[model samples]
Target: MANLKELRGRINSVKSTRKITQAMKMVAAAKLRRAQSQAEAARPYAERMARMLASLGQAVAGNPDAPKLLVGTGSDQVHLLVVVTADRGLAGPFNTNVGRHARNHIRKLEAAGKTVKILTVGRKGATYLKREFASRMAGEITFQGKKRVGFEDANAIAERLTGMLEAGEFDVCTLIYNRFRSVIAQIPSDQQLIPAELPEAAAETASGEAQAWYEYEPDEATILAQLLPKNLAIQIYRAILESAAGEHGARMNAMDNATRNAGDMINKLTLTYNRTRQANITRELIEIISGAEAL
Candidate 1:
């Protein structure tokens, strides 16, 4: 229902949009490759670390001298939710899904009469929570211009969190982020960071695997004190890598869909433009024939 000129303009606009979306999709694909590789590579190491910590944690389970990071401050009354999101979006719900999950968790904690504190990583997550959780924000970390998320980035976050934990800012901490599953599937997950949740299997394995005479050289407690902090950094690093890969995968899918939709719109507009032009030409020809007949 638009004039030819208007239709032409609309079609051109869609074509331009299509071009942009196509470019974005290609860029996202390129980025996804590297990000995905990095994420996949980190998994084995992280899992191994988790297993090691699980074993060490079991050894110190009943010991009062165990690292506080492993034993916690003995209260779950106050919870800190560390929400991780991408710094940039265009990745559809890659960021929003995680944010929504975190929000739901916060609400659930509040409903249970537990105090909630928020420590957001990435600008998008912070912005998402700020609308409702501004008062509960303990701090925020943004890696706006970082080309790639590295262990250093995770270490920085770990250091701040460690400081906060030492300060008694919160009793328990949970990290929420998207876990990279596939190009089309980024699953949001929650991990308990502080007082590291030990698997029941860990206790069983530890007892069976240990020999009565097997003794830790530096002592199990001493090794745990050192490893617990490194494990936190490793876990955080893995989360960031998974989030990075997932963001690219989500963006690639979103842009591909956008490009296809734009192409469809352009085709529809072109069809309308042709029909309208034909109608106008036919009317002009009819007028000429009628004038000649009148003559």
Candidate 2:
């Protein structure tokens, strides 16, 4: 049993912690609103671009001159996993979940006798993944204090990937991230990046009817040459936006939970302190009364 003084000190500490957690929760809530809006806004544009790419892709499926970005290197022996995660912690499992998924993926790739390479974006993930997948790490993109994420960032990453692809560093690439579903739910997910894709639903489009009416201006090949790279950048930008939103959501939820738990602790400690102090005072009063009666 702790003495009255110790219990009082503990109560004070818990109250202070509760205040800090409350402040963090507020900040996270504000950030989450803005991030959520940005992510929601990007979804449609990204989906439309993906649909257009899919429609165009059908035209050049077998053509020898299709963009390499669309067709890949015709090999799956080497794979690159571009894992996206928060650059900071305190976001309950957001970074860890992605890292876990990537870890499993890397293991599966290696198991299949395929060479696997890792490219991590964000400081949090690099540290988390480096423990086990350190040998497979090809590079890391760290933006510790970057105020905002923008399309230019995605474009830069895409360009770096294109350079590596052109240099035959990897045959295929995949992106892993968290998709923001709600404040309490950020779904860890992955998307194919190297040989980009439309939504799975797009794959089942009206095949014969759609192809007969479509016409290209310069040519399907000519349009794809300009579009495929842009599409890649778009996809990456979408992933970044999604990840940014998810991180904030996770943080908000985490801080909220922390604040509540701290409040509960404060209540419990305060009760203990009051009871212990009362017990101490009551014992002192009894001792004084007994001495006076004896005298």
Candidate 3:
């Protein structure tokens, strides 16, 4: 049993920890609001862009002159996995969950005799993956110094990826990140960007309809050439936004749990201290009574 001084010290330590956790929880909550709003705002635009791309892709499905981004290299031998995670930690399993998902994908690809390469977007993801997939990591990008994620960040990453693709570094590219669905629910998602995977709506149109009412300004091939690259950048930007929101939500929940656990521990320690002190006082009172009776 710890003495009063030691118990008191422990209680004080726990109280201090509780204060920190509480503060972190509040901070996470504030950040989550902004991040969530940004994520929500980006979703519709990304979806609409995807739909438009899909429709356009359907129109030019069999065109020999189609952009290479729409009709990819005729092989899936090399794969690039772009994993997006948080640059910082203390967000519970936000980073771990994404890393695990990416790792599984990498393993699956390897088992199929396909070459796998990784492009990590955050420090945490890079560190987590380095333990097992270090050799497979092609590159890493960290936004540690950036106060806010912007289009420039996505554009730079896109330029690097497209440059690598044009250089024949990989045949297919997939992006993995956590998608923010709600404050408590973040879903890890994988999307194929390179050799773009046409959505179901576009796929349907490609197989069933022959439309003669389509018009293009510079020509379908030229428009697709521009749109395909823009789509990649936009998708990356959306993924970053989603990851930002999910990270805050995960951190907020983790901090709340820590705060509650700290409170419980404090209560338990206080009870123990009170009981011990009461027992000590009873022992002293009994000794005094015995001495008086004997006298």
Candidate 4:
């Protein structure tokens, strides 16, 4: 039973909040367009690169001297999880989803007697995971003020991962992030980076042949040595792009919902305020009439 002054104050506060949410929704929508396009464009290239590497690495996959990036350090004792999330919040569960997914993965790995290490790519993720997995955190990277994230950003991360692999820091590496699907849907996904996950070989070629024959110019080993690292960077870039788009989409959707909720609240409050004011006026009128009759 708030008085008129209190009701007015509450209404004004909600109105201000509604304005902010509306502005944020529009801003997120504008950003989502560019981010979504970039994410969609990177998918094909990344998929093709992965397929090519899978085909090329088939011969050397079982060899003892194969590139470590392709075959790993021959141990699954140590696992590295590279979790990608947004540097900022107010995007609903965009960052939380990835953090939770990574946490569950770490728990699963630990249950199986594996040592888990975390490499967070965003501030929100680091903060969320630091609560429980602080001891397991290997490193964190954030791009808070950066206007855009490009391949160079992904390359730097890839290089760091390569250095760690060479130093025998971790045997298996997996990336966790949100995959952009639509304006309102984002799927949390995990991809293996180190010791590349090879797709199954196709039984028939597009030309209707049982197998496709191709010859490498410098031989398979020579090509793989150079291609494996590039493939790693490309995969990371793709994941980053996907995460960027998903973040924007989630933010836009969240802001839109917030704005709508705010509007509904404002309407309810305004109705209540009017009713209260009317009630007060009626009470004052009745009091005045009672005084007149007494006089």
TM-score of each: 0.95, 0.94, 0.94, 0.96
Which candidate wins on TM-score?
A: 4
Those runs of model 2 whose alpha carbons end farther than 4 Å from true positions after fitting are: 198-212
TM-score of 2: 0.94
Residue 33 alpha-carbon offset, candidate 2, angstroms: 0.9
Q: In candidate 2, how many Å is residue 152 off?
A: 0.7
What is the model-wide C-alpha lDDT for candidate 3?
Answer: 0.90
TM-score of model 4 (CA atoms): 0.96
lDDT (Cα, 0-100) at 5 in candidate 1: 98
lDDT of 4 at 224: 90
Q: What tens digits encode model 4's per-residue C-alpha lDDT throughout 252-280?
A: 99999999999999999999999999999
- lDDT-based ranking: 4, 3, 1, 2
Candidate 2 lDDT over residue span 158-249, tens digit each:
99998899999999999998877878898888888877654553354544334344689998777888888888888888888888888988
Q: Write the per-residue lDDT of candidate 3 for residues 147-241, one digit (tens) a residue.
A: 89988899899999889988999999999999888878888889998888888764546767654456889887788888888889999999999
Candidate 4 lDDT at 290 equals 100
For TM-score, candidate 1 versus 3, the one ahead is: 1
Backbone clashes (count) for model 2:
0
Superior candidate under lDDT, 2 versus 3: 3
Tens digits of per-residue lDDT for model 1 on 154-206?
99898888898999988999999998889999999999999888866545456
Q: Give the residue spans of candidate 3 off by over 4 A.
A: 202-212
